[model samples]
Target: MTHSERWCWYSLLLMLIWLPIPLGSHRMWSWSIFEIWISCQTLLLSASLWHQFPWQKIRKFVWLLAPLSLFQCWIAIQAIPLPVEVLSIIAPDVAQVYRQVGADVGSLSYDRYATLTGLMKGIAYTLFAFNAVVLIHSVKRVKTVLYALVISGTFQSFYGVLTVLLNSHQSWFFGLPQGHRATGTFLYFNHFANYLVMCLCLGIGLIVSQLHQTESGSWHVRIRRWFSAVMSAKMMIRLCLIVMVIALIMTRSRMGNAVFFSVIACGGVIALCFYKRRPRALTALIISMMIIDTFLVGTLFGIDKVKQRIEATSIETETRDQAVQWSLDIIRDYPLTGTGLGSFYSTFPHYTHYNIGYYNYAHNDYVQFAAEAGIPAVVLLSLPILVALWFCFNVIRTRHSKTLKGTALGCLMGILAMMAQISVDFHLQAPANAVTFILILVLSGCVRQIQVRPESHPVAVDHLLLKN
Candidate 1:
């Protein structure tokens, strides 16, 4: 990597740690702290990468860009000024809002302002993901990013678990509401759980990859290996995984808990299938994960509440049911042109039946995305996960190193977990979780770095995976 590239990588790490602070850098009402900071950070990195931009590297991941650009294109269509008569048919709910104010509702979308803001936020996130793909170009940097993710996630989970154990209602560090759940630095427990779930997936891969527990000789060797508390990479990853699981349990989020364990299970299966050479070690890893996760974390965190929450699921909560119904109506009325991005908070209120309270989030990302950006946006977003899965499985089958393959498979599971969790909660909407989500994507989608020989210099793959 070049000198400038090193600084850019450092900047990326700082941003990862920084995004969760200051109320999770959420509340982007009117140019909030995250908005200003993210904009500057994104632009600077984008400019630096512009000169020696990894077009070859980036184009290989065009599966991501296609849907992203399509979503933005849908946003652009929403911004255009259209004839009122035409819009009334395409976006009647939006027209109704404008008509309610005696303004030319039919001439424009009610969500134009929100669409612009949402598009800007999406752009910033994409830029940061690209930066990671460019800078994290070697095994060393890749390991650094993964460990950074695990370490930062562990710190937040530790704080969250600490606060919960003390029965505090707000953070000792940020003074943010604790809400009876382990939210850590995030505003919602689900979001904190979301962040930790990804970390846990990574931790599992790291632990498996770093595991040197091979049965070679006698029972004494095996016994010593099992009991040793060495401060090695494997041990740290294992430790981080344990704490993150415990903290996730503390969050008491039903979907969060369910999605994480399910994904972890799937990850274990992937490891066994692909890491066939390490059958014994992988089996031990799986057994250890299961024992630690169930007996230790679940037992201590009082998993009953979450279990009951999951089993007692009805049609839906009153607020969420109402929100989903209203969102559907909004989508139906504006099938072609969405009400606009970021309009869920403003538009859902008009369509609410019970007026239980204000709902900024639609609680379901799918419902909200479809309502805000139309069904096409939902389609655009959904297909990328499939593409991601394909990319991950390709790496598993093609990559030479066991660690690189495990990391890719782990990221695929993490993305799956995120998708499942997002079905019930808007965790990805949070700045911290979203940035982490993108970083994981970069890791999963990365081909060049993983394909390079490990013994080569960091920049050896600067031109890998591209045809001249």
Candidate 2:
């Protein structure tokens, strides 16, 4: 990597590390700072590498990114003031509000300031993902990113676990009493669990990259390979995975825990059934993850609490379900053009019938996005994930490089987990989780675009090449 590229890479690592520190950067001020930081990084990197920009690679994902671009444009449109006639034609409710207040002009957005802030943050996230793709031009860089995520997750896991063990109720930075829940630095347990799920996926992918092919060999050869693994650096990642899993269980988040285990099971099944040359080591890794992480470590770390939460959850008891109903009302009223991006808080109250508490977010990302940006915007947001999922699936089915396949599997599982979890929670609303989700999406789509070199053994490829 060039000096500038190296700095850019470090900048991404710094961003990843800093994101979850300040309540998942969900606060306006925290997110704004990172937005400026990432935008500056993008500008500087583009200035330094404009001549050698990877246009060819970026072009490959044009179809995937086109909708996102349009969605951003849509957000901008929501924030832009339009003539009264134009506003009336597009979003009559917004225009009606203006007229009732004796104003002739207004934006589609009910809260223009919130929409603009959302737009700025959205742009920063887009550029960060773009910069990540541009900088990660090699398998070595991919591993570096994965390791950085694992390390960050491990730190969060350790901190959260330690806080609970110390009987501390307050977060070190946010001063929120977590009440035995391991939220780390994040304000919400669900978002922290979601973040860990993504990190675990990447860490598990790293382990898969380290898996030796299950060829017919003598017992001595198998034993030697197994012993080498026991002594290898993979143990650190394995330990990290364990720590994160423990923290995940401590969160007692029903969907978060469910999605993590579900992804592992589904990913394993897919690999066994679909991978072109599935390795036995891969099967072993998956089995170990399910058996050790879920049964053993989980047993010791409040898995029962998560199960209790799941079993005890009911529609009547849960107010979020009611909130979703009200959110659906908003979506129903504004199907074509939503109330506006970041307008859920402002728009939800008028439709809310019952006491669902003072909910700023709809608690369901799908519902919230639909309520804020309309059904079409929801489609635009989901399109890239669907496209990226296909890319990762193909990588698993067709690629020979273990690192590529592992990364693909990680991206695949992470994306699926996020998709599943977002059904009832707004984890993606947290900027940290959102950016991490985007990075995984980028990795899934871009992994296939990068080429690989010939290697004697697929298992040894990443390690040897990275070392060299």
Candidate 3:
């Protein structure tokens, strides 16, 4: 970490911490600032790392970004003005609207301004991921960023808990009263829960990265190892994880909680079935998280509320199902080119059911994305996540470094969790959550680029083995 590189990464860290603070950065002003800040960071980082750009390692990841780049290009095309005749051939509906107003020019997008803003956000997120990959080049730096994420999450958890404990009716930075739901700095409970879930995954991975693969040595040695773990920095991280879990439960987000526990179960199964030498520490950590977090901490918090919400969920009770059904009409109408990025709100009104109220999002990310950007765009956006998941699996299956493997496992679970949650709610609509989700996916693909070398410290070397 040279001085310039240090400046780049630290600035990025500050951005990540700042993102969720201003109502998840969903407000136009906040996200505008976010884009400007990341753009500057990208420029600074690019200039500093121009001498050694790690082109060899970056080339391996280019294919993973192809679909994303195409998606952005597609959005840009939608925002561009075109003659009405060209628009009619591509998007008849858009052309019909222009013809109704006796206009000779139009674009595929129903709302070009919204589409352009969406394009800017898309580029910002892409640049942010690039900065992360290029700046976090080593295992130590990776650990540092992960720790910072956990620390930021812990602060959110603590603040959310404190607000609930005070029995405050008013939400933070908003007039709506959240009651018992813990929303942290975010206005929405589910978004906050989703953010915490990602942080918890990273914290758990950091712990796994530090754990010895297989327990060995005499009774005294094993006991010492256990004691050291209980009294180490990992213990503090564990505490943070617990706080986050408590906050998650307090949020009372049905799908958010369900996706998290389900992903944890899936991760444990994959590890046991695939890893040749299953680390005792890995199993213990999983068991503790499942039991301690869900049972003990949850019992103390409001896990029952979360369970009740899940049990009470049904098509009849939820309006989002209706929204999703109506959104399909938009997809049907614009199957080829879509209404355009960020055009869902405007386009959905035409198909909205009588029972459905005004909704900015379809509440299902997949449906909203398809409705807004067309089916092809949905596939394009999904490609990077699917490829990143493959990368995570490869790292976990083949990498000798426990740290890398653990990080991969965490990223895999986090991505899966987000995917599951997005099927029911548009967590990705929030800029902060979207950015964090992209970071997790980017980090997963970056595991191969991490240089794993033996350290002088016996414990450090024991935890992160030399790469084969």
Model 2 clashing residue pairs (backbone)? none
Best by TM-score: 2
User: How do the predictions measure up, each by TM-score?
Assistant: 0.87, 0.95, 0.95
Candidate lDDT values, in order: 0.73, 0.86, 0.84
Q: Tens digit of lDDT per residue, candidate 3, span 35-105? A: 99999888887788789877876676675556667888999999999999998888888899999999898
**Candidates arranged by lDDT, highest first:** 2, 3, 1
Model 3 poorest ten-residue lDDT run: 459-468
Candidate with top lDDT is 2
The local distance difference test score of model 1 is 0.73
Q: What is the RMSD of candidate 3?
A: 3.3
**Local lDDT at 141 for model 1:** 72
Off by over 4 Å in 1: 29-32, 46-51, 81-100, 105-108, 212-231, 311-319, 447-449, 454-468
For residues 1-468, what per-residue lDDT tens digits would candidate 2 score against the true structure?
Answer: 578877888888888889999889989888988898998898888888888887987787675567767888999989998888899887777799999888877988889998998888888877887787787778888888899999999999999999998999677767788678998999888999999999999899888887775573456556667777789989879998999999999999899999999999999998888876777778878989999999999999889989899899997788998888878988888887888888888788888786667989988999999888989999888888888999999999998888889899999999999999999899888999999998898888768887988658633544454457
Could you give candidate 1's per-residue lDDT for residues 1-468 as a string of tens digits?
555556767877877776775556676742255556656665666676777877887777677766777777677777777766666676565666666777653443466787778877777676666667667776667777778888888888888888888999768866766667788877777788888888888777666655552343555455555565364567767878888888888888888888887876887777667653453577767877778787777987878878877788776554676667677887887665567788788777777776668888888888888877778778878786787777777777666665676677678888899888887778767877887887877787774345665334212232232212
- TM-score of candidate 3 relative to the true fold: 0.95
